[model samples]
Target: MTHPAAPARRRFLISALSACAVGGLTTSLTACATSTFPFIPDYYTFSQKQVQEAVQRKFPYQRTVSQVFEVALMHPVVGLLPDTNRVSVRLDARLASPFLQQPVNGVFTLSSQLEYDPQSRSVVLRAPNVENVSVDGDAQAYTQQINAAAAVLATQLLTNYPVYTFKPDQLQFAGVTYEPGTITVLTNGIRVQIVEK
Candidate 1:
């Protein structure tokens, strides 16, 4: 009968040989060794010009969104300012109410930081700040009262808004997946670094 310990000895020898081969890595041997394992680190840069173009396309001249007390928001101009590390939106808004027969014109400006959410696999806007506000005449008093509320509203509108959302199929390109990192804001654009799983 075959020795019972022989099989165990053989297996141990085989494992030892394999480990030796891997640890001692010959150039030819390593070159032939295949790894289908996917994932690599990479950088994807998106330019400010691209963002501006997209914003223009998305809003294109003027768009009205949300209304309160018969006052409506309109005429938006979006901007990506690297100096501020934020994306800004300037709008020409008019407040109209039963109390006021004429529409009150004012400017509203908001800015938001850009960030990458690895869990969500997208670049999104966060914590919008109402940086500036200007209302002429009597509208100034009314706007002052609602400034906090308006900022909150704007923040809500911008919160979690995707600056760039990647699809799964797109992530598969060259074994690249969503990378977990901070957004680098530059004068021309923002760069996001990605890595393999």
Candidate 2:
């Protein structure tokens, strides 16, 4: 009787172990399927092109000379435990300088809200803060200056957009050129340097 019971217990143990192994495999695959792509912490750096495309989609023309606007992400946080993160985007812009041929460089206080969805592995950016500056300069020069300024502003805005499907080379914004494989973006608050590829 004892020998018969031992064999039954051994079979039960084997069945239990097999079931557990299958369950563990399923859980791991599920996590992988839901995980976001390019899991690198600084993946957003590669998103410059996508951001530019979204900006172009948002604004298609450059005919007026009212004020220039741009969007910049401040304190971007990514890779939180689950799939949520927060980032602040400031919209900085200036108007064409009445005295100078180009627009005055100044910081605007516009703010934006960013939300990420882990299940979908996607991020959504919304602009809710905006500040505008008026241009005061020579009429003809200001017109030209504003147009030039707008081109640069558009380029910068596009570079900072939060999506990942667009490319900067496609917009062809004036004054702002992307020298791929030659430009280096620094993290020490240094100005971008463009070199020959």
Candidate 3:
């Protein structure tokens, strides 16, 4: 009876040891996986910043315009959230056509939502809103309406423009000017030549 009991005790110890070893190995593997990429504190925040910086670098002179445009188009709640992975831009632009006498100033706004997948290193852009509009008008009611419409157009334009990778070559429409092979869009279609460069 004593001999049998001793064998049973030895078997229990062996099983316990094996379980502990397995648990330790799992923990070590988990740690290794998590440690492989520790530089990214918050991926969403980083990506948003990258986008913001890119915009700034793209149009450093238009920083103020970009901020206003973005705010107007983005959903107030979505815009305010931290690390929400979205970017918005607003532009107040003035144009004078050599063909026309009067100069025009317009307000444009755009907003976009971006999602990134860490596993695939893939970035996805959701819907965008764009509002293109004339802000200065004689009638107060008309001015308000135009401004509202501009906001909507800006949202759409912003959302789509980023995805379109709008080089200065793809835009073409009636009343738009392209030089040889390139095309560009002017926000105020009525006031200026949409020149390609």
Candidate 4:
């Protein structure tokens, strides 16, 4: 005769098998869902156009040089330097002074390295250097003065200027505090990696 516990053992085995089958189905469904929806990283990217717009907000900047000439900087065009991990801005400049018969139109290009400022929770441009300056019409008379003024503007005005500011919510994720760490310049944009604090 079969053992008394034989039927009970068979019932337990069948129940365990049924539970395993359900668990397997659930695991398979989860795997498929994960495959379809990839995980996102903790990083932020700003396109060239977005950066350009951010830089443009500061303009048109005006400065008086030597209590004489007035320099107006406007229409900023931003470009990314991936190799150096820097940003370049070209601005349309207009110079007006009593010494000159008419206002002079010119352009100045400046490049700067970016740094994160914890106090302000923002990415700022630092140590901006005016790469070049050129004027239209017969403005050669003031080239030297114009170059000097451009240098001053790059330092006094653009330096330490915030390119992007992090919102309070952006720095916090999943109950953990994160801050911007490595900033990389890409061909078409800028990438900021966030790290736990």
Error of 2 at 165 (Å): 7.4
In order, candidate lDDTs are 0.64, 0.35, 0.37, 0.82
Which residue pairs collide, candidate 1? none
Q: Which ten contiguous residues of candidate 1 have the minimum total lDDT?
A: 26-35
**Alpha-carbon shift of residue 61 in model 3 (angstroms):** 12
RMSD list, candidates in order = 11.1, 16.8, 18.8, 10.7
Ranking by TM-score: 4, 1, 3, 2
Candidate 2, 30-132: lDDT as tens digits: 2222122211111123333344344335442323333432222222212111121222223333433335565444333333344332233333344433323
Ranking by lDDT: 4, 1, 3, 2
In angstroms, the error of model 3 at 180 is 41
Query: Deviation in angstroms for 44 in model 1?
Result: 1.3
| Tens-digit per-residue lDDT, 127-168, candidate 4 | 999899999876778789878888988999888898888898
- What candidate 4 gets wrong by more than 4 Å, as runs, is 1-40
Off by over 4 Å in 2: 1-86, 90-94, 97-102, 115-121, 131-197
Total clashing residue pairs per candidate? 0, 5, 21, 0
TM-score of each: 0.64, 0.26, 0.34, 0.75
Best by lDDT: 4
Candidate 1 local lDDT, 155-192, one digit each (tens): 65667777776667635555444454657777777776
